[model samples]
Target chain A: MQKIFSYSNTMILLLLVLCAAVFYLTGEMSSGAELFPRITAFGLAFFGIVELILSLSRKDSMEKPIKKENNQHLVRKSVLYMLVFFLLVIFFFLCFPLIGFEVSAIGFMLIAMVLLGGRKTLRLWPVAILIPLLLVLVFRGGLDVRLPTLFF
Target chain B: MELFGAVLNLLKPLTFLAMSVGVGWGIICGALPGLGATIGIALLIPFTFGMSPLVALPMLAGVYAGAIYGGGITAVLLGVPGTSADAATVYDGYPLAQKGLANKGLTTSVSASAFGGMFSALILLFLAPPLAKASLAFGPPEYFLVAIFGLTIIAALSTSSIIKGIMAGFLGLLLGTIGIDPIVGDMRFTFGAVYLYDGFPLVPLILGLFAFPRCMVLIEDLVRKGSSQISLNLDDGGGPKLTWRETWQMKRTYFRSAFLGTLIGILPGAGANIACFVGYASAKRASKKPELFGTGIPEGVAASEAANNGTCNGSLVPLLTLSIPGSPTAAVILGALMIHGLVPGADLFTKHAEVTYTFIVSAFFCNIIMLVMGWYGSKWFGKIVQVPTYILAPAMLLVSLVGAFTVRQYTFDIGVTIGIGTAAYFLSRAGFPMASILLGAILGPMAEAGFRRAMLIGQNDLTIFLTRPLSLALVILTLASVFAGWRMQKKSKPMKDALSGKKETQ
Candidate 1:
């Protein structure tokens, strides 16, 4: 496998130049906002490049040998958990208008908790249900904002 | 004289009560592992939604001040370090606790925190107008430079490699850029998900990056070790007390650390965690017994605690005077200010003089509350560590859900929270600094809006960015910081290598 950029200054520099280009082309570069991102990008790139050069030139290595983590299983589990969360979110967005925000949100949380290895399903049930129900009541009922109810 | 009246008026019963609640809550949450002052303020924001900004702001500010001091409790007692800001305290604090001097460590922390909070509040009250003028001189380009200057402190933070730390910061910035382009309204990395329109929700992302991942990792450890059975016998009480002799002995260190912390806090993007470590290190080097630093000395505790609390004061100077938030907690406070329809800037002083004075006086009030509550609640706060991770995890998750939903009453925001939380977790594990990412996310839209407006004023000429003296000086400072950081890292590498080798050989 080809080694990707190790988040050095060069990559940062490239990102800044890209941002600058994007800002310039979008005709938004004239704003003071463009200046901050541009300057940040430029400075980050410069420092990163210098560091990269310094590492190449130095005879003695200063970095400690990388001790890679032996948690690929954990990483995999987390990644899978997140993917399930993403899909659940997508499903909730679709179901919200039909089923209502409170119900969908509750369902989303319960599923997400279970997928993320939430043990003690009994404990999870009340939290997953009650929290979203309280929010809809507080924000919609108390604040009196129009929320997506099935009939409304 | 006007300031004196402002201070006197703040001593009213209502203001004192608000200050106590804020500080008391701040310390309690701050003492919790994976929670900090920012979360403390974020959580309380909902409760304060009904109150007037005058009452609400001080109440929240009290929490901000209290939490920074409170974090030292966990650092000393459990070796957990409570919030990330108190991580430096662990060096001396845990050792002190082991030596059965936990009360002394706790006392020193409270005293230093109070001193630092008072010092910074004084600075804010008297010197804020002049500093506000200085802050106003900064344009977008200058703020961008300030952001870089903030990131340069990563060198001080990096114990492993400068390369790794810089990588983490840059990746964080990139992560900050992941959402829709603020100027163009085009999504960059959302992968066709409509929920990511606002990029990441700050509270949940932070909670996930700092809290969630830590909780997940700790679960395995807790299971393996079986949770440590440490109980706080609340009756074994050493009440709130600090000796003048002890204060005088550490006065110089306290002042120096507070000054250093305040200065760093004034700079955008940096936080109290960075300040505490810097203060602790500088104190150790200057101490008579530099070798005795990690052995639970009062000076080290004073340095860390003072620096941490000093940051709270320093951060507000910019937020109130210039509308620029120095840290995430300050940023959340800015949101709270906006929620109350208060825009921070030059007008903040003249237009809302009473409110402003009330806020300033509240700082002093909050500091006193921190001392009082930290003493009274120390034993109570210590019991929180015994709560199971399983319970705390879901509770936090539930809070994050509500926090997101409450913001706009949009389920979309809650969805955004989960997405942002998930992405933030990955970004953090991949070695990105969540703080920088947050800075970028929060400040990106501002910079974009400002830069575009400035360009229209100058007919799109890039030279205008440098033509302004404030912008030019900021550029120079930013350059100097980057160069200085690189040089510092280069110089420190060999010493670090030597130290590690010495340990290995022993």
Candidate 2:
């Protein structure tokens, strides 16, 4: 057990902690609402503990090595870019209710395109602008699906 | 007869137009790397919100059938399987391409795919109603067990460790418990957020799991290589198309593989890739010249195509019959049905026969269209592989954001979706089965509702699940599936360890 703790299965440990926190939060709920959550929490804890024990018992199970070839699994990129994409998305949606849909979406697309390495071409601006405009037309005019719009 | 006519009447210009366009777009998406039936269907689901069931369902069916066949295009020409469903094709297909038989590989694959797709559709048309009728007898305890059965199948079929899959599933179920309780009005896990009242929206959750992750992946690819595009030799004009005589020779291979695929697909948790590989192995075992399978053979391509496409409709059988999705794609379809206020079950067949019949009938036509379009559209489809990731990534990001927001016309869902997508990306990297997470979330609510109702009725008797015949059978099946899967993994691990250079256990 001491040896098990010496090797860090960091992600699994994090997940276990998260599970515990979620389970503890469920304590605040009414009994009617808490039943299913409690069941799921119990499941989460049970499987997590079992997996930890198994992971610990395996040979050199500390942290699994990454596959170099599988792009679907491990991505080779800087944390800064990942943070940029995440923050860009978070910021755009945060400003959405204030600025409405078209303005925010179009702005989000243009900025994200530049940030994500879309080439600077004459076609870029038109595409970034037109997709949202065309979407507004099809969904709003044709489908009557409401999208938040601003006067600007 | 009128119902048949009504079903056939989906041949209207609008529906036909939608089918062709959907199939064409699906072929393009599928021919591209990292885009498959799941992403294609998820991206298109938003567009279906405005259209009638007749318009929308046919379009979806077209995408489903066409995207799968489209995957074979990349596997043969580029040596990259467009989807995991097409992975089996790559072994034999790339070899054929190298031997200057790209045309034949493409032809055999498309033809076999069309055959397999149509065969499964016929089975769905003929077989679904009776199965749905049988499902009418399922009580709450049975439904609960059915969900368990589906989860077990997933756990069994997980390529990674079963424990990790179950843990991911548990995490998903735990996430599902965030909204108002089914039995009572009180909220659980809301944490004072108004958005939590409706629970996590399906659109955001799905987009986060499947779509957004791909977008981020595309961005990562762009940064890694300054926007890379798929390049292939289009100079050969693809050698020669397969003759009818050659196709006729492979008839047994096609039918047997399709049957195997459909049977596997009918079982919960066995996805198209599993069907593809099993069919490939079966075809090899039954072959007169099994040695030639990986050496550029038409039989290999045909078997791979037939099985993968066969699973397309086979996976739908359980979804249409019992609300238990047979695969991840079927899970998305289940979500679509629920979104449209059309739950899958007995009522889907009897109450909404017009929509249900029309949906199944459309799949038949979609297969025919896939054959027509796939055979002729190979040249244009190949060009889509060359499109740069930078442009595609931004477009997909915008679409995913819009898709999540428009589903309920809430901007909060967009934030929620991106958050889930980021977390899902990390989880996937950690060797968790992402699809297991998806399946768990989809089935969690049903399991909870059934469990609660069964409890209320049985006065908290857990034996109600065991007492009912159908439920008991399902319980046995689930346990057997998990055990068999565990045993199979244990058996395979030694071989896997010996084969792999760097063994990573999760």
Candidate 3:
């Protein structure tokens, strides 16, 4: 059961499903428009299946059970950190236009630095503040390129 | 006379200033671990949006040249390669530093880098015009086949798993088809967003793929291994001086490596990363003291640095003439060219001769600038590697996202960049080559346009790609290239394993 739902096998299944979805969606397009996407979808599916088979045949399908067990906690912690980082990015994206580039960027930088273990130090605060201000000044004043600003 | 005029244009104060600043920034980026030439250029693309093509393109070229040379600085001093292109330099360079001959290693690397860069820049100057002229004969069928050839070569060579690479490329092609159908104007996958009318903007996409993932990795590293800054101590005055006589004696090594690097760079998929190793191995093979290669030698440092920097201009040949990017950095430059409304072909030579020629000629001065900066600023550049990942990661993320926003001035572009970057990070973790995906996105439209046009021309006959002599030649070449790339990958696997094993043992 584990072998059947392995990483490579799952990736292959996802790719095949994606190919089918592309073909289904492009079904409404004219023949000329659909031709290239169809070809690419088919090629993707073909390679995905080939890789799946190769992965199944290989002895290195998964790490040794002992190593996997030992590393599972570390893996989970890393994944958690990744999720936090991603959520922060999403938050920054959502707030960017509302709060403007400077406020949001500086906020994002501070939060990110703190999350990445800079909470113990005062060093990150100045960098977090100064970099956004400097970027705004340079982009707006030096290059005359506008960043989203509350006043503007 | 045109070449002379191009030189004069490059000497203009603004152009020269921009070029020098680019070189300095590139050196800093290259000396820093994690940020290399591609991301450096990607981040700089937004700033170049306001400048003239003459000022902008040469500056980008300077960055490329300087980044390649700058990688050797950290490789010599710290034993860590600042970029993949400097991996080979670490073998001898670190040992030289350990032996208190760091000055010689630094001088040798800079001198050789300058020589190789100038050598390849000359080749690009003389060779690209004739190649562009030849490309003028390429028709729709030939173009379609050429795009296919580029994709296949990249897929075959970019990764250990060719199938994974090919699949990543297909995914990129699929992404490219999302906005609107070029031929029939049918909206395929835009999902009703008006911003998706023209598809994903190239600048943001490049930045997201190349820069964002690196930022993520840096952040991840900070989390995994506590956020301690790297510390360095260097004694600048304790190394033997590299005399001109010593440098002159390695002329044969310089010539051979530079030639090999240029040739490798002209081929799609291969870049400075491969060229440096090839140069190092070739030099070792030719040396009477081959066994002493990794044991602190100026020749070894010179060989790797020379070949890698030689690739700086060599990779531009195909990019400027055939619309085929010879390396990932060249791909970014291709996006820059498109942003400036310049197409790569005989049209560049005939219609935009001044811009094209000036850009090519600027490579010469860029190399000279790289030499000066690298020689005098190695100490300062080496210190940049000490920046903490905590600060670098968040700063990079902010800069990259903002750069994405600047491209189209749409908040949506930033969202799209973040989306693509997140997907790219996952895809890369799955062992798919990002470069293959990038090339696929870049060439997808070209392939689609060519295929549709050729199909129309041949009345829906698919063999139109094979019927023309030029198309037939391209088809044959594509097949040959894929086969060669496969064999090369197979051949290099053991060597790669051995090198990794050595690193582990060390």
Candidate 4:
């Protein structure tokens, strides 16, 4: 056998399990309010089951080994890049209210660009500096949206 | 006449200034790969609270119209589509660019978009009330069926796989249940978090499903082929220039696709992407030289451009007449209206007639401005695709994060956005349609409310849906749609494969 399950089948199974678990955990509530959740969960599980069953009929082929290997480097790099991005975003989120939009905005943009492309993107200096300032001017100055503040 | 008066009132300097700014921002957003109109509207919702309905509606509508049209530039000049709706445009548009007929492709696209936008707007103006009047007789059971009809059509036509699309939609409905119950204030899946009480905010969910997934795709492209630049040369422009004659020649394609787009937009769950696909496919099928499609053909550009742009007004039909958003971005627009203390539906036509008429009328003028902007600015807007990934990625992420934060001014919303975005990335890789998921989320509340209302009205009798004529008809339509989708898949297997092969090679 190529595997116990295909990748999609595994995800479908996982989703089915989540549905069952969520439905079971709902306990007893006003029947009407719970009705939508119950119906949707049940429906999702039904489709998941169908997907799982259909996935079994698919035969995995080891075709195009060279192409797969060639793609490995790019896929790995891209995954790493995304992880780094989200981590930076999370840090920005954490520091947002405390350090304020102005500081975090500049830091986030500069750090993220450097991480993604090194110093080759120094040419983007103007755009990098201007965008966040423009956002502040529009949201804070023009619209009077109250951002978490450090400096006026 | 009242609508004309409302339009005239919006001719003031302040209105034009606001609209110009909004349209300019929208064009820039639509030209960028990861940023689309939904985020544009989401960020603007909070800001619109400060402006009058007259000023706000025109500005938002201008943004809406401009964003839809602006996508044509990148689709023509670069192989990359500015928006998903413009993906079909990339098929013909990019080929024209490679042949140095970029101006022709760009002009055809802009003109098609303008025609489609104007046609759909006229339909909305003339057809909304009658279409809505037909729904006035509809009650709880019919409402449930209407929601079900939306889900069924999405499930059937949105993806290559019917079951997967339905599952994706169902997953959205499940997420929609995360907040407080509409009928009874009990929280089902809040898991003891105060944030869950309001459910997942639509902005976060939309970004997660629609916007963030693109980031993942961008990452793959960036990694596989490091950032690339567009090759531009106006002196070497070798292909036939677009003429008024060619524009008129494609009028048949324009009308058919425009009508198709508008009708699809009127359907609750349908959006611009689906409209473009159908329009392009139908255009190819109806062509004498269908073989010429995707070969930098003007007909191909016309179909996609018109259909995708047509959906703007097509979607407004249900949004204005019924208060049900016809697309995800339209849902964001609905939020804008809500903040301004204006509810859609019959009340808008009566109590807020001025605002309603102005909003509808403003869409017409917005399209005109969009046409002019797209025609003149194509050369500049088309250059946006050449930006380095490192630069584009950070800018898009920062703007998106900031927009997400501004909505509720909460960090938790950002978490939700990122989490959902990650899930959407994986789901898309696994072949689930994100549009279906978005539709599910948007339609969930309406479906739930309708079901609950039906139960209360019918005293727990499930037969009420079957007993009501409109509901029963809708139920049949839903089933028919599913069957039609099955047949379409089976019949088009060879054609679809052939088309994809041709598209890739060209």
> DockQ, per-model, please?
0.17, 0.51, 0.66, 0.60
Ranking by lDDT: 3, 2, 4, 1
Docking class of 4: medium
TM-score of each: 0.74, 0.92, 0.95, 0.87
Which 10-residue window of candidate 2 chain A scores lowest in summed lDDT?
Answer: A67-76
Give the alpha carbon lDDT tens digit for every residue of B210-314 in model 4.
Answer: 556665566666776787666653456535667988878898999999999999888765679778889999999999999999888989999998999899988
Q: Which ten residues in a row are the worst by lDDT in model 4 chain B?
A: B497-506
**lDDT score of residue B127 within candidate 4:** 81
Candidate 3's residue-wise lDDT over B346-431, tens digit each? 99999899999999999888889888887777777888887778778889988888888886788898888898898777666566
Worst 10 residues of 3 chain A by lDDT: A62-71
* Most accurate candidate by DockQ: 3
Candidate 1 lDDT over B130-221, as tens digits, reads 76566566666665545444454443344444454555455456545556666655655556766566665554544444444443444434
Off by over 4 Å in 4: A1-5, A28-32, A59-69, B33-53, B79-101, B233-304, B322-344, B490-506
lDDT tens per residue, model 2, B1-506: 53576556677899888888778877877887787887888888888877888788888888888888888898998887787788789879889888888888888889999999999998888899899999889989988888777776666655557877787877878777778877777887777989889787887888888788878766765675565545665577778888999999999999998898888788776778778888899999999899998999989999999999999999999889987777777777877777677878899988888888888988888888889887877767878888766567777878888888877887778888888998877776566766667767777888899999999999999999888899889899888878887887787677556544321210
Best by lDDT: 3
Off by over 4 Å in 3: A1-4, A61-69, B227-229, B236-240, B500-506
How accurately is candidate 3 docked according to DockQ?
0.66
> What tens digits encode model 1's per-residue C-alpha lDDT throughout A1-152?
01123333334445456555544543533433234344545545665566656655556533322334487665555546545545665686668667876777677767766654567878788878886777677667765645567645
User: lDDT of candidate 3 vs native?
Assistant: 0.83
List where candidate 1 sits over 4 angstroms from the true fold: A5-152, B1-18, B43-51, B135-253, B267-271, B281-293, B318-344, B487-506
